[model samples]
Target: MFFFERAIAKQIKNGGGPYFRYIDDLFIVINWPVRHLLKQIERLNNFDENIKLKANIGSFTNFLHLYTENRDGTLFTAVYQKPSYEPYYLPSNSIPPLHMKKNIPFIMLLRTIRYCSTFQTYLSERENLRMASLLNKYPNKIIEQQFNNVLLKFNIDQPLTINNYNKYRQNVLDSPYKEPTGIDYDKVLFIHFTYCSSMEMFPLKFHTLWSKSFGESPINEITPVLRIRNVKNLQRRLTH
Candidate 1:
């Protein structure tokens, strides 16, 4: 996940101009200035490495891998996707590699939610209806309330059941086919995709949403790729 962020950031920094890459799948707005896009491609080509982006764009696969190859000599590789299966493909060269830190499970959950949003339009109406039911059944406000109530009760970040579990349980029991309530899954997806794409232009807004959603000082952890220095950087690059 971090690798995808880094790669997209790298693209924008080098004039790749912001795109999403998940495993072999890639998504880009493709409305950037041609010169900027070209310069990014040129910069990538000049490197002793070849960067390839791929994605299935459907099925929402078990996981995704971000693959890279350095043509100069050895390869620099990173796996952004968590493994869902084994027999993990071994590199032929038997090259031991440096490891990248994985984000916490909650962070992963946030990302998965955001990623799912990108394809909201692509989802079948039935699927969306099902998701809507799920969200309506377990709305974000409810989820946040549940999380907070539990947090306060336990005085720790460790997982715990919400005080209203029985109520939620009863609701579920009463309407087994009904989806969760109060969750704006559609809105969440729309907001996340728009924010990520425009973060370079709206640092303040992006960070604001990030902070609110993740419950932390956004700047401290939300490092935009290209190593965005500050809001000024985002403003300058976006307008330029």
Candidate 2:
């Protein structure tokens, strides 16, 4: 066991009774982690056996609660950390239970990528392919298609030809215009092409997976407890 777990176990034995444990989130809101807590919970469950764990993480929403104490006459009630906007605490007049609020966007392809790095590692290639395909299929979708038209108007049709791809690339790279306009449009096309192609390579299948699971790929809903836990970890690191 980790030192924190051991220390918590010892604290439970010496001080407060059983504690609330969030296994997946790796958080325990107990003053002392009692070694026999699981056994105790099981015994309690026998009396009122309707409770079921919501996730691998232990929380009141999943199971029952028990009471514990502190050295300074504090009442340390042990309950799994229920998903909430605020920290879990006793229902004193000052602190009330905060129900969780969910807000996630669909098509947050960027956000979802952080969880599994497999997609991020190859994002550039994915985006490039997406852009290339998009440009090939939907010429109108290119932000700077007008540039090609302008070149054509100047009777410079060779630049856009497949055989003259390198020449076209060189003209765009060397062009002084850096924006999406008749004068300087390749910049816009290049950027759009890069991301569109990269995203294509990145995989729309993953987006479909997210959509299937959450009803939408762009907007999503995640465990609020997890979001809070992440914020708390960040705060701790910053403070430390």
Clashes of each: 20, 24
TM-score for every candidate vs. truth? 0.19, 0.17
Model 1 reaches what TM-score against the true structure? Answer: 0.19
The candidate that wins on lDDT is 1
Q: Give me the runs in candidate 1 sitting further than 4 Å from their true place.
A: 1-46, 50-105, 118-240
- The lDDT for every candidate, in the order shown, is 0.39, 0.35
Candidate 1 at residue 151, lDDT? 37
What C-alpha root-mean-square deviation, in Å, does candidate 2 show against the real structure? 26.1
Instruction: Estimate the lDDT of model 1.
Output: 0.39
